[model samples]
Target: MTNPLGIVGAGIGGLTLACALEQQNIPFTLYEQAESFEALGYGIQVSPNVVRVLAALGLTEKLEAIAHRCYGFELRSFTSDQTLIKWQLPKNQLYYQCRRADLHQLLFDGLRDKSKLNFATRLTGYSQTTDKVALKFEHAPKVEVAGLVGADGVGSPTRRQLMLDSQQTKPSYAGYAAFRAILPWRSPYEELAGRATVWLGKNHHVVAYPNGNLNHGEQWLNLVLVVKESQWQEEGWTIEVDKSQVAAEFQNQSRLLNQILKDMIASPEPCYKWGLFTRPALPFWSQNKVTLLGDAAHPMVPFQAQGAAMSIEDAYVLAQCLQRHQTTEGAFQQYENLRYQRATRMQITSRKNADIFHASGLKAIARDFVFKIVDAIAPNLMNLKSAWIYDYDVTKL
Candidate 1:
């Protein structure tokens, strides 16, 4: 199709979509609110599901060089300091934990030269006639296109303009805060092999994993601490926080974990925090020539670690839908039909995992018991259970 497709947000979802559409010989333009395509933040888990999508885009070699392959996730009890579950990951499936910047670069670099990726071009408003959509930008010239994609994330301007109903569900605070930081590898922990680890405690949890290429000496370790809180001010993930404050929150944690936090807090850089938020399921993902993708369509808790994965899935499926259908609207409806249920299920599952991960009192003990039994009976159960998610091949769909 020669009709130009416009995408807002150059995030994982938007960039991936741009690349996929390009590969399919589709014409498109990508607008990013950021000033430049600079890498941001600490680390993210790219499960086999996401890896499969990246591989389809021919990014395997570049990504593999920078990502740490984790065999599985180990869950431990914070109070007892005992291993509760050691769920073996998928056998043939490889999971990578890489710096967010490195992943972003891989996607950004993959876009075709013809793909117009305009930075600092924020979406201000948009209007649609019977045949085309006209997009207005904050600092750039307006453009008319066959379709507009709202890959702009949870605070999507397209969503706001399209679904203006006062009753529409807004993203609410999830009553928890997460602090993520990257520390230089040092000594014992440095020598320790790359693996993902989760320490679960009452009302909080800590997840750590090796990030960056293993060949680049010892890789940097990424740490994320989620704690229940009464108030959260920031709504976006990039909001800044005091490192000392974050350190204080985890001071009562295990000594070993506390040491890690101290090192993170002592870093010269400011720590960031954001209140996780999600919208109630929208009845549909599209209207006219406009549609949502990634966090724009479905935002989920990070407990499942599938936020980026879902967006990757959306990117591939959306391109497929457009390729298979005659009109933009038809393609959108088909995309929603194929994606809504899966995204909603993932959102619910992530929420459920949050409850389990943050269990307190007797509930925490029960959770530990279940983990032990499951680990003993089926060492690979965790990996097996997520097979339906991780093993999915979107290209074949």
Candidate 2:
């Protein structure tokens, strides 16, 4: 009997890759470090590019049933209360605004009958021979996989064992921190039920959008606040934070905005906070039979909301490369080549957005002015600027 493929981390990237492999009738096992599937109290934007991949994977109907289709994104200046830019999202393609949990559940349900998923199994180490790879789990029996795909995320242990110096470009605090929470859709903000809004300031930004459906009683809004900060030692996504401190971070903003932050803080649920981190592009994404995917390969800031989208793209393309190539090593090389430039470009662009959104003095004025003019004359063109990103169809390749 042929050995099944082994994947670490049951994230969107991992699960999506697993589904793709399953579609091709390739056997695989997914190991998640977590004890069980649970909501992580965070929200992520599913851009059209990612939506297309999901559609190809036969998940569009399920996703569309639960997600709110965000029409356009608007950037508003906090000081002047004026709209800086209003770019319409791509048409025909659907962009979902659902919680990470809802999306995860969708993928999990899709794989419910696969009989190959293993949870609470943490990967401790791995060894790769010329033809196969063996993985060691902390509390589970060792399993040998035909190939190891490390979708284990930014702090990937598999990547640590395989790479020469995986810790060299360690995730550093990008001089900023983010606070995210989900609120039940109430009135007043209900006007924002369908659209995504970005309130931009000198060194801070607030983004809010609805998720789930109003009729299904699953309607909720996801809000994220990014603020410039001096220090951040914690690196994981599940870091705990003080509510008042989060509210204080945006004390200088408008009262209405502060009220939103205050409501989020007062909620019974715990708020997760973390210093946004990014790693320098690795020279290569693979070594022999082991390769990296998602945050393990390219961790980027959330400036462009492409973090998860890129990972979804990686899973699709990596699967494609593997299907096309004869050997694991060849597929890894091609996957790196096809994905490296685009991911790196996005990483650089997301960083630039951080700087541009936080600029002060003359730079800030120029930035705002450009956004206004672009919104007025060429709104569609402004939206199409991201066509290179949104229009990417991995299946064709």
Clashes of each: 0, 0
Indicate which candidate wins on lDDT.
Answer: 1
In candidate 2, what residue range of length 10 has the lowest lDDT sum? 250-259
The 10 consecutive residues of candidate 1 with the worst lDDT sum are: 185-194
lDDT by residue (153-271, candidate 2, tens digit) is 88888777767545675666688888888877767576576678888888888888887866574777788888898888664655878888887876654555666777877787677
RMSD of 2: 1.9
* lDDT of candidate model 2 versus the reference: 0.81
lDDT of 1 by residue, 1-397 (tens): 4468889999889989999998887778888988888866688999888888888989999888888888877888877658898865756987899898888888888986733988889999999987889999999898898899999988888887878743574566777888778888655465234578888988888888888887774478888889988787654566777888887776654666777877887766567777787767887879989999999889888998999889999999999898888788888889989999999999999988889999998899898998999988986877767887888888888
Q: Listing every candidate in turn, what is its Cα RMSD in Å to the true structure after a full C-alpha superposition?
A: 1.8, 1.9
Residue 235: error of model 2 in Å? 6.9
C-alpha lDDT of residue 153 in model 2: 87
